[model samples]
Target: MASKVMMTPGEILREGELEKRSDSLLQLWKKKRGVLTDDRLRLFSGTSERAKELRFHSILKVDCVEHTRKYVYFTIVTTDYKEIDFRCTEESCWNAFITLALIEYQNRRAVEGFRRHRFQRVASEEQQEEPGEQRALSPW
Candidate 1:
């Protein structure tokens, strides 16, 4: 588990309850608040214990986002198909925050993967070249 103090570097975009449908059987909604941060989304129950942590790297996509008169609703779908629902006051716009963070995370991952692949290809090519065949600086 990541320390909350260390999590400070991550911005907290929103803090509010995990919303439930009127017919849902789960009774714990009142105690759990969805916390949106730059690196992860967390569900915190009561205070000290973290119910769940969904890291940006593990997120496959945000399945849905909906709004009603009273609140904004969104669902985060993880790589493993775990769906987490959250809602906040209409003014918070938590859905946008989560979407932006996920986008940024995905972009960064893509760039890093590209860099690693390029480096490996260059290194392998250099190894395959004969010592005297290496390109030399132009004297002219």
Candidate 2:
């Protein structure tokens, strides 16, 4: 029989070596696909004081940049997570967002690698649709 072990967002992030890997902050969005404990979600969702301090709400989005035949790069969007009317200290929020962004980037990198190996003939704009339309038809 296998024993069950629970994981936290912090643990997952730390295990990936996200902090030491780059100068920027990192955040990984582990949804239903990844194993996450309720505690981890609570920590990430900012229900507790510690979570709030981490600036969980400061994350806006993560963008992956794909270069031809090159590794995908991640950029994290930063915002103020604080709900008060007053302005937040730029340093704290900025750092938090960056950290989260880095983690998310690392996570994306792993996923992208897995997908590339699993799927052949990955859809590209050039291959999927006919010319003359401004936008390519996305299966999404």
lDDT of each: 0.72, 0.36
Candidate 2, run of 10 with poorest lDDT: 14-23
Candidate 2 stretches with Cα past 4 Å from truth are 1-5, 14-55, 80-140
Residue 131 in candidate 2 has what lDDT?
Answer: 53
**Candidate 1 wrongly placed segments (more than 4 Å):** 1-28, 49-51, 131-140
lDDT of 2 by residue, 1-140 (tens): 99956544555432111111222255333211111222122222222233322233444454443323422233444465322111113322322344454565557566988899666555564456555353555543
lDDT of 1 by residue, 1-140 (tens): 87543334577867776553332675333445678877788876667674678899889887557778987777778889877666666776667777887897798789999999999999998887755465444343
Q: Which candidate comes out best when scored by TM-score?
A: 1
Q: Estimate each model's TM-score.
A: 0.71, 0.24
Q: What lDDT is obtained when candidate 1 is compared to the true structure?
A: 0.72
Best by lDDT: 1
lDDT accuracy of residue 137 in candidate 2: 57
